[model samples]
Target: MEAYCSMKAQEVRKLIREQVITGQTSGMATGFTQANLVILKQEHALDFLLFCQRNPKSCPLLDVTEPGSYRPAKLAEGADIRSELPSYRIYRDGVLAEEVNDITDYWEDDMVGFLIGCSFTFEAPLLAGGIPIRHIEENRNVPMYKTNIACTKSGIFEGPTVVSMRPMKAQDAIRAIQITTRFPDVHGAPIHLGDPSLIGIDDVSAPDFGDAVTINEGEIPVFWACGVTPQAVAMQSKPSIMITHSPGCMFISDRKDSELSVL
Candidate 1:
């Protein structure tokens, strides 16, 4: 993993494409942006794009590949969306049908791949800001939950907003908010802090997705809009076919964290 982190985004992607590194991409390719992936048929693309636009915090649009094209022209040159991510989840009629390391077998000529900004892209800045990221410290993927909060519906896409959690001291949480707010493309500032239950998260120790980490004394749970929301919405809407990077397995991009930062 150390070796991979030092490599450039394209190199990390090549390894993923060749099945050399099949694991969560949480801390990989350090300074580059990592994106959440969603692939839907061309017919569903416009509606999905509108859904993303309606819910920017959770589904920040990073890049969208043309129909049937796996390459994300703006995010990463020479990257293959179908094979670059470590894992993928295939949903049929809104239910997860299978999980695979590669989607080459399922690619369709009319499919449009959407690359949504992921919170991992902002962690480097948070770390630099002196804010502790529990998940990365624990060597685990950030915890995520499906919230009771509903997202605005667009065409056939609609579902509860999802959030990723990271527990931190109040001061650190505040600093994290200030730091993350600068990278709006990557989920941005926390949507909620202190109480997990208020956002419909019943248990802080047990996450719906990714591994749970300790919330230590004097620390509060911070929640951010998650890229997972799109996939959850797709499940509820029951798209005839939908594919997404399995939770925590992200598509690392060539774009730098500095490039996406506003200030």
Candidate 2:
């Protein structure tokens, strides 16, 4: 993992494309910006863009591709969105139909890919601030749960928000909020901390997506709006089709994390 942590974004993407890295991208290509992918037909692009606009906390825009183009010119030039991520999820009529390592076969000329800001992009800064990220330490995907918080409606896209969790001591969580607030492009700061029940999460031990980690005796679970919210929206909006990165398996971009920092 240390070897992967030191790799350049392009190198990490190469390995992912070649099926060398087939898991969550939490600690890989450290310091580079990571993004969540959502691909849809041109007809649905406008509505989805509005959806993102209305729900910036959960779907902050990073780089969006032109119709029929797979390369995200602003994020990772020349990189193929169809196969760059370690895993891809295909939704048919809002239901997850399949999971694959490559989406080349499903690509359409009218497809537009939206790369949303990922919380993983801010994880490095959190670690640098001495805030230990439990998922990275436990070598597991960050736990994500559907929240009662409803997103603003945008066309057919409307659903409860989803959030990623990281258990931290009170002091570390405070520092995390301070550090992450500098990167709003990514889901910045903790939306909720302490009790999971307040956010409609009935069980912290079993998450809606990803793996749960240890929430030590003195630590509280901190939650941040997650890029995975789109998946939940997809289930409700029932789009004809949607393609997204599997939860926690993100696209590693060439952009540096500092590039998105406001401070």
Candidate 3:
């Protein structure tokens, strides 16, 4: 696992497709872009694309696949979305059906996959800027929450925005905000900082997804619009079927981190 941290994006995707790696991708494939997956039938693609456009902060569009195509031509070369991700979540009629290592059984001719930018991409820059990522330091997945702030609706997709949280002291939080703002494709900057309740999170220690890390005495929780927002929003619409990357599990893209930076 430690060695995988230094692996290139393509190498990491190869390992994932072979089922040799099946966990969160927070620190792996450093300096590469990691994406959130959302696959739906062609019937829902347009509306979902509109939903994404309406909620750019939460669902920054990275790439999209043609109907029935698993290859993400723009983000990765020769990458099969069905088998390249570490894990996939299958949703049926607004409910989580199951999680699988591969989506071959569920792949349909009319399905379209949407790749959304993930906050994980900015973690590398944050570290370079001297902002420590607590989850990476503690060897745990970064905590994510389902917030009370409702996302703008488009067609059937409508729900509260989900957010990823990192607790940091006032100064670090401010620096993190600046560091992350340079990458608009990867959520840019935090949507909220300080109280978790302001976003409707009842407990900071207990997250809706991923593992919780200890928050130091002076650190306050910083919240960023999360890629998982689409998954949560899509589920609310209760489409006949939907698919997404399991929380923390991501699709490694060939694109470099520098490509996503605004500066």
Best by TM-score: 1
Q: Could you give me the TM-score of model 2 versus the true structure? A: 0.95
- Give the per-residue lDDT digits (tens) of candidate 1, residues 1-263: 77887888888888999999888886788898899999999999999999999999999999999888999999987789989999999999999999999999999999999999988878888888888888888988889899999999999999999999999999998899898999899898999998788989888888887889988998989999999998889879999999999988899999998999998
Give the per-residue Cα lDDT of candidate 1 at 10.
Answer: 88
Per-model TM-score, in order, reads 0.96, 0.95, 0.96
- Per-residue CA lDDT of model 3 for 5-48, tens digit only, reads 89998999989989999988877888888999999999999999
Give residue 92's error in model 2 in angstroms: 0.5
Give the lDDT of residue 212 in candidate 2. Answer: 83
User: Once model 3 is optimally superposed onto the true structure by TM-score, how far is the C-alpha of residue 139 displaced, in angstroms?
Assistant: 1.6
Best by lDDT: 2
TM-score, cand. 1: 0.96
Which residue pairs show collisions in model 1? none
Global lDDT of model 2: 0.92
TM-score, ranked from best to worst: 1, 3, 2
